[model samples]
Target: MSDTKNKWHAIALVAGILLIAVNLRVPFTSIAPVLPLIQNAFGLSASALGLLTSLPLLAFAAFSPLSASVARRFGIERTLFGALLVISAGILLRSAGSAWALYAGTILIGTGIALANVLLPGLIKRDFSTKMASMTGAYSITMGAAGAVGSAVIVPLTQSWGWPIALSLLVAAPLLALVVWLPQLKKHEHVNLSGPKQAPTVAVWRSPLAWQVTLFMGLNAMPFYVAVGWLPTILMDHGISPEQAGTVHGTLQLTTAIPGLILAATLRRLKDQKLAAATVSLLTASSLIGLIYAPDYAMLWAAFLGFGSGASMMLGLTFIGLRTKNAGDTAALSGMVQCVGYLMAAAGPLLLGQLHDWTGGWTAPLLITAAISVAGAFTGMLAGRNVQLEHAESSSRTSPAIQSANALTAGERKR
Candidate 1:
């Protein structure tokens, strides 16, 4: 009976993690399809819309560095559960009433997501050591798919149910995630994951390789966020209807998922991911070129961009796990990478939006995006090299409690 119960608990834990992952991006992406509607309703300009879209990302940048410390203080499982509740609250508050409510809710959402995003990679590193890539892929697929579906359906839902209610519907995801995550807090109540009393800290900001990974993550994210915030608008500019544009936007997101699924299968055999990273960047660049020069074939460009962006996202996450030997290091690197990376990412939509407003067209902005893709490709090549972050001449200390817990976890995983 004991063994059976433990087995069931393990299954539930995995289910819960996936559930939480799905909630991470839905709140952010759901707003994209209805962006134009919201802008018109609120009487917002292009630059104002960009700020609205980027408000969460700016929150992500600001809050990311605090997540690891917050997790350390509160316990990772409990922290994650709290984050879900916060996300739910943010979603509710976002639709509560005025423009201020919406902006305030978005900041709350970003804060919650920041906590989840930085901590999850470390949790996955700690728990699913052997199947890192596959697990990352699983969660990435869930996240990407949810975002796409949300984007696809939001506009139509707005048409039928109205924008505020349509946006409010997203609260259900985090609420469900919160319920599923409760079991984990109970299971891990006794486990001590807080690091050594005098833990050695690596200056991730100083490490060349860390910077490479951070740059790759940041650069790819810039284009990805830019596309999410404004790609439908760009398509609409090319004469596509709003409904069809939403569908195409959704399709682009779905395309991103395919590489994740494919790579999950092949990751076990793959030791080096540099080529994969380069390929993803190249595909995104090509897509941008197509979008700029061949506006008539926007769907094809969207597909290419989706495939690259999706694959790069997975690879960026996988790099975090692969480059760390333990959970603490994972957390530290995750925090650093996301903090600086997201700060850089926050510039994407804002700058592009301003550029569009100034130039009165998409050409300059698209060219800038293409340049970003090239930069991402270069950084990906450097970041994807087979190297671990702990070997960067940084001292590492492990507490006996952590080591014991790891041993026990490893033994159970073998079962």
Candidate 2:
């Protein structure tokens, strides 16, 4: 009976994690499908619309690094609960029919998402250390599926009801997540109170391996976001109808969810991820090349691009847990990785757009993204090594007590 109870508890935790993941991407993706309605509602300029879209990425960059410390001070479960409330509030505020509320709400939503993004890997590391890869893949799939659903439904809902009503409906997911996650607070409260008193002393920013992981993830993000922002326009420019281009875009997003299922089943069987990383990078580059040379095969290229991006992202998240010694270090490394990675992602679309303007063509921008994907293959090779960040010489500067604590935690995890 005790064993059965424990198993059910573990299952509940996994459900909670996946439920939170459902909220991670839907809010942001829901906006794109209804952008025109929003713009018209507020009489906003094109620049304002761009800023509205970019605000979330900016908030992610600004708030990501700060999440670890906040989690350290407040328990992770409580912090996440607070984040869901913030997300719900943001959704409501954004739909309140005002421009200031819209921007403020977006920033709030982004800030809440930043906290969740930085902390979830560490939560998995703490609770599901042995099953890190599978758990990462599961949550990645959940996020991708939720985003796809949000994109698909928002336009139809907006047309039927109104933009504000359509947008405000997103609050339901986070509210449900909050209900599903409530039990975790009680379960984790004791652990949080009794866990190591001293925070991680190893500086993730000072470690070379951490930098390699950051760059690998950052480069992967560049091409993925570039495509997300520009692929439909590129397709239309190549003579595809708007409806066909939109279908291809949907295909890209739907296919992204496929890789997480594959990786969840296969990632743990491998000794290291170097080859997997390189393969995904090559797929990304090949897809971009196909897009440039064979515009007629846009659907195939989009599918390939989606699979490559999805796999690369799942690997990057997995690396956060695999490369760290403990949950604290996982949070620290996650913070550093996402802070830099998302900033690069924010810049990617803008830079590609500028390049397109300067060259008066999509070829140059696509080529540049392809080159970055090729570079990511090399960086991924370095990051995919079967090594932990704590073992690095630069990370060895922790005090004797901290070292002993880490060793004890590592031993506990191993057992």
Candidate 3:
């Protein structure tokens, strides 16, 4: 009877997590594919349009560290449940009549995501410590799949049900997460909320490895977000219909999503993940070349872009997990990584738009992206090294405990 009850607890935990993961990216990515229609309707400037693409990310960038601190104080269940409700509210507000309401809604949506994002790795760490790689892989795949669906469908929803209704649909997924997760709240309550009591001895922000990881994560994200924010629009510019553009976006997303699952399941945990990092860089470059130089074989370019982009995305998440030793370090490193990383990633869509306006073609942005992929590969190789974040000589991302561990190790060696 006890074993059966434990099994039930595990099912509830997995369901709650998958449900939460589905909501994180939809609101953010769904806005990109519909940008052209939105800009025309609002009579917005390039920067304003950029703001539209970046609003949620900005919210996340500023707020995620707070979420980490709060999780430390409140434990996971209360924070997740309350945040889900906030996300639901935010999604509905986007359907509000005024611009302020829509933006306000986006802010709420972002806060909700921040809470979930901050908690997820810790939850996985706490619950599935033994299966960290597989569980992280599972969550990572769901995240990618949800992003693909969100990006692919927004345009179709606008044509069929209109933008507000289409966006409102995103809220439903999070709301469902709340309902499914409500029952599990009590179970997680008893789980410890406080991270290890020792003061984190090292300053993560000062670490060179931290910046390398942060930049690699950011650059890898740029092409994907740039494509997501503008790919459908770019395709339409080439005379594809709105529906056809959506299909292209969907295809690209599928390419990215499937690779995420495969890499997360199999390739993500390797100590030397630099090879995978290199693969993403090369493929992203090839895809960009095909798209910029050829532009005719849209389908072929999409496949290459998806495969390259997808693997890179999975590696970023996996690298963070694989690099860290405990949940506290994961939380701290993830906070720093995404805070800086998203700020950098937020530029892609907006920059792509400004470049397009200046050059009268997507070539400039495509060329720029090819260069980013190359730089990302070199750094990813460094970050992907087998060393743990805390003990990794001078090359690892910093953590409080890593320095302490180093001191302890050195003292032991001297003795």
Candidate 4:
């Protein structure tokens, strides 16, 4: 009976995680697949259209800190569950088609997403301390997969149901997540995730490794978001049909999902992450070069792009989990990275677009992106070292019962 109950709990957690993962990318990815139509409908300028595409990411940058704080206060599960409802409202409101309603709903969606994003790693650490790495890997996999679905399904769904119906379909994910997580509300209690023992903010701020990670996380994200936010358009710009293009874009993200799982299973085996970071960065660079200069090899380059993005996101997530010592540190470091890093990412898609507008080609912009990719790996090499934060909370403080309950990852246990 005890074993059955434990298994059920784990299943519930995974289900809730999957639903939350589905919610994470929809507000952002759904926009891109339908962007041109949206722009035409609203009669938005290119800059305004770019903002429409990027608003959620930009809001993620602005709201992650507050999101983290809310999680710290409300308990991650409650924050996640409640935020999902808010997200549902955001999606439905955005469906209603007024300019003010659009911005308002966009903020609600971004705000809810920010809370969900900030709370996840720490909640995983606190609850499934045993399966931290595995669960983190699982979360990352679903993220890419969901992103693929959101982009690829939009036009098809729109064809069948009209754009609003297709787009508002996103609200279902968060509502389902809330239901999956409902039972956990009374069962799991809050742990203080950002307490005083976790050193002052400046101490965390001063760590070179922290800055290195922030850069790695942010820059790596820039490309993926660019792909997520702009890739379909870029492909269409090259003469592919919207459906074929969405499929190709989806394939890239699906590629990201597959390798995320593989890399999750293997990152522990890697001896030097500098090598790991550089290798994936090189893969990403090669893929981009092929993409920019060799459009004929679309399928092949798509695979490479997927592989690189998957590896890069997985590594960044791994480093975030690896570098911190405890839940508080995880929360703090996560807040810093996601807050500043997401803001930086919000710039990538828009920045390259403006450049493309000015230069009359994606060539100059792609070159800049490739440089950023390499730079991410260079910084990741420094951040990915096996060193822990010098002043972060001790890992041993994780309740031993919780430690045993989840079969915590070795590195998670070691801290």
Candidate 5:
């Protein structure tokens, strides 16, 4: 009976994590499909519309590093619960029928998402340390699927019920996540209550390995977001109809969810991920090159890009857990990586857009992104080494408790 109860608790925890993942991407992706409805409703300028769309990413950059510190002080479970409330409020406020509310709400939503994004890996590291790869894959799939569903349905919903109503409906996801997540608060209360007192002081920012992981993740994100922002336009420019381009875009997103399962099943069998990392990065670069050289094969290239991006992202997230000695270090490393990674991601689309304007063509921008992807392959090779951040040179300055924890973790791994 006791064993059965523990198994059920683990199942509940996994369900809760996936439910939160469902909220991670939908709030932003859903807005993309209804952007025209929102712009016309607000009578906004093109620049204003762009800013509205970009606000969440900016919020992500600003809020991500702060989440770990906040979680350390307040406890991850409680902090996450608070984040869901913020998201729910942001959704409703965005649908409040005003420009200020719209931007402000987006910031709130982004804040909540950033918190969840940075912390979830740490949570998995704490509770599911032995299954980090599989858990990361599971949540990644959940996020991608939810984002795809939101993108597919939002336009039709907006047409039927109007933009505000359509936007307001997103609140339901976070609310449902909250209900699913409620059990975790009690289950984790004792650990969380003592978390602040027991947390270690590890200088993840000073670790070279941490930066390598950050760059690997950030570089991979650049091409993916670049594709997200420009792929449809590129397709149309290449003479495809808008309807067909949209279908290809949907195909790209749906394909992104596939590699998560693949990695989950296969990653643990490998001694190290260096080859897997290089393969995915090269795949992305090749696909971008394919898009430029063979526009006729856009669908094939898009699917390849999606698989590469998805696998690379899963690996990055898995690295956070695999490279850390404990949950505290995982949170610290995750925060640092995401703070830099997302800032890089936010800049990709804008930089690509500028390059396109300067060159008056998509070829130059796509080529630049392809070159970046090749560079990412090199960084991924370095980041994929079978070494933990606690053993990095800079960790010599970490607190005694951290060093002790690292020693214990190393000893455990040997057995």
Candidate 6:
């Protein structure tokens, strides 16, 4: 009976995580397809429209560093639940059809996602410690899939039901995630609200390996986000119609989930992911070359890029769990990596656009992407090195008596 009950608990936990993962990208992605309609309705200029798209990323960089600390104080489950509420509120607020409401809601949505983004890896570390790679794959795949679906559906939904109803439709996801996650509130109640403070450790800013992971994350994101932002425009410049370009872009996003699903099914751990990283870099480079030179085969090149992008992101996320020894370090490293990494990624689209305007072609921008891919490969190799953070290392050195005492205290807190 106890074993069966544990299985049910695991099921609930997995459901909650997967549901939460789906919400992480949908709020942002669902806006893009109907952006022109939104701009028209608001009588907004190009700069205002651009700001709508960029605000979430800025919010990510601004709010991510605070998430780990918030989780530490409030408990991960409660923090994530609160994040879901924030997302739901943001979705409704953005759908209010006013410019201020739109920007405020977008910021709120970004803030909510940033917290979930930093905290989910830590939660996985705490709960699915043994199956890190597989569970990470599940969440990562769900995130990619949600983005694809959002991009695919939003335009049609807006045409049929109007923008407010269409955008508001997304609130259901977080609301469902909130409902599924309620079981965790009971678990949270068992957790003590406070703990004895420990000596402050040096920040992750001082760690070389953490920097490597952050670079790997940031570099991979640059090409992926750039592709997401401009690939359709690139395709259109090659003589494809807007509708066809949209189709290709959607296909590219859906393709990203393939490698994650395969990884989840086949391999969950790697001593060194250097070879995998190299594979991603090569695929991305080749895809970029194909996109620049062979517009007729855009679908095929996009498939390769999507596969590579998905794998790189999956590897980056996996490292968060593989490289950390405990949940606290996982949370800290996640915050540091995502906070800096996304700030860097947020610049990708703007820079790519500038390159295109300067050279009057897609070649220069893609060449930049190729270079970033090679750098990503190098960073991936460094981050793939089997190592743990300094705090985890020090913590591991504690005497068995002290370790036992700490475990007892943790167990008491559970009671």
Clash number for each model: 0, 0, 3, 3, 0, 0
lDDT of 4 by residue, 217-303 (tens): 888888877777777777777777888777777778778877655665577787758888878877877777777877767768877
Q: How much RMSD separates candidate 4 from the native structure? A: 9.6
> In candidate 2, which residue ranges exceed 4 Å CA deviation?
1-15, 36-51, 72-74, 124-135, 182-209, 229-247, 264-273, 292-296, 318-334, 356-361, 384-415
**Positional deviation of residue 114's Cα in model 5 after best superposition, in angstroms:** 1.4
Least accurate stretch of 10 residues (summed lDDT) in model 2? 187-196
Q: TM-score of the candidate numbered 3?
A: 0.82
List, residue by residue over 1-415, the lDDT tens digit for candidate 1.
9999989987987898898898788998778877777888888778888887898899888877777778777878988998898898899998886888888998899889988987787788878889887887788778878887888888888889988999999988998888878778864443334445333255576677778888899899888888888898888888888788887787787787788778766765777888888889988988988888897788888888998887887788778878777766676677677777788788899988899899999999989998998999999889888887654453344557777888899999999
Between candidates 2 and 4, name the one with more favorable TM-score.
4
lDDT for each residue of candidate 6 in 263-373, tens digit (9 for 90 to 100): 644434566777787678778878988998898999899889999988888788778877776666666677687778888787776677667667878898899888998
Error of 1 at 16 (Å): 2.0
Instruction: Assess candidate 4 and give its TM-score to the true structure.
Output: 0.83
Model 1 accuracy (lDDT, Cα)? 0.82
How well does candidate 6 match the true structure in TM-score terms? 0.76
- Segments in model 6 whose C-alpha atoms lie over 4 Å from true places: 1-11, 39-51, 127-134, 190-210, 233-246, 261-272, 318-335, 354-363, 381-415
> What does the lDDT come to for candidate 4?
0.77
| Candidate 5 residue pairs in backbone clash | none
Query: Which regions in candidate 1 have their CA more than 4 angstroms from the true location?
Result: 125-132, 188-204, 264-275, 318-334, 384-415
- Cα lDDT tens digits for candidate 3, 1-415: 9999999988988988988888777766667667677667667665566666677777778887777567656658878888899899998997775678777897888888887887887789888999987887778668767777777777777889877788788887887898899876775453443455444433567766667777788888888777767777777777777776767776676677677456654673465888888888788888887887677777788878888887887678767777777766665677777887888777877787787777878778789888888888898888878876554345345467987898899999999
Q: Candidate 4: list runs displaced more than 4 Å.
A: 1-10, 194-196, 200-204, 320-333, 384-415
TM-score of each: 0.83, 0.76, 0.82, 0.83, 0.76, 0.76
Residue lDDT tens for model 5, 1-415: 9999999998988998998898888887667555545767889654465566567777899987777778877778878888899999999999999989999998999889988877887799888889987898788778877877776676567768988998899999999989988987874332342245335356778888888899999999989977775676677779976456656676677789898777766989988899999999999999999999999999999899999998898889889888888767887787788778888887777777678667878899899999999999999999999998764445566688988999999999999
